[model samples]
Target: MAKHTTLKRGQLLKYIGKRWKNLNIISGNSFMKFLGYDGNGFADVWVEYQGRLLFLSIKEVELAV
Candidate 1:
């Protein structure tokens, strides 16, 4: 089963200078700088990967490295 997480604002910030590959686990895909949590188990994350910008989810991601 895919692991899920409830990443807090502060915790999610840790991925700032990191790459999507650094994300231990991902449910959907991968960020930028401004992410908004809807308080309904979903979060919007922006990331710059492969010279492109990507929007990802929070609940569907896990960090275990």
Candidate 2:
């Protein structure tokens, strides 16, 4: 089951903008695809978007709608 999270939209953008490695959505996809990362230690699990910081669980990403 995916875990529902409620974070401000602005925070998500902040994490992406402030963090470079955190902005990587590719590694994240691979992890979500194959089930884990090779050695990059799963991409950013939390992000700031639109003045809100959204913390998401792995399950949530896998079940993202």
Candidate 3:
């Protein structure tokens, strides 16, 4: 069984320095580094995927903790 947790801003910091499973990536599945949210009033997650970093909406990905 897999343990899944909703990606929320409150636990964003905790995900830092750790690896999480992202099941909603465009390329099937991928491992993302949680770099926390941006400071634009909206909680956007900065994820590093496939050697490239990108900003993604909180609802755009399903994170498995």
Candidate 4:
């Protein structure tokens, strides 16, 4: 079985400036750096797959751990 957890706003804020592993499930990039909330129910993140710095918004979904 796959373990999943919901990412709350507080939790997401705590991970800012940190590398979040396994986030590639949404962008195909394994390690993503958590930036901050967009205040629009989406979390901004930096994908490591591409060299360029692009901000991607991640919707609130159950995270598979």
RMSD of each: 8.6, 12.8, 9.4, 9.8
Stretches of candidate 4 off by over 4 Å are 1-29, 43-52, 59-65
Residue-by-residue lDDT tens digits, candidate 4, 1-65? 11122244323211123346643343333443333444554444333333434455453222334
Regarding lDDT, does 1 or 3 come out ahead? 3
Candidate with the larger TM-score of 1 and 3: 3
lDDT of each: 0.41, 0.34, 0.49, 0.36
Worst 10 residues of 2 by lDDT: 9-18
Candidate whose TM-score is highest: 3
How do the residues 1-65 of candidate 3 rate in per-residue lDDT, one tens digit apiece?
11233344333222222234653344434556666567654446776765666676655545545
Q: Which ranking of candidates, highest TM-score first?
A: 3, 1, 4, 2
lDDT of 2 by residue, 1-65 (tens): 22233323222121112234454444333222222222334442553333334554334443233
Q: What is the TM-score of each candidate against the true structure?
A: 0.30, 0.24, 0.48, 0.28
Which has the better TM-score: candidate 3, or candidate 4? 3
Top candidate (lDDT): 3
Model 3 steric clash pairs: none
Model 1 residue 41 CA deviation (Å) reads 8.9
lDDT of 3 at 26: 47
User: How many clashing pairs does model 4 include?
Assistant: 0
Candidate 3, residue 60: Cα displacement in angstroms equals 0.8
Q: Name the regions of candidate 2 deviating beyond 4 angstroms.
A: 1-44, 62-65
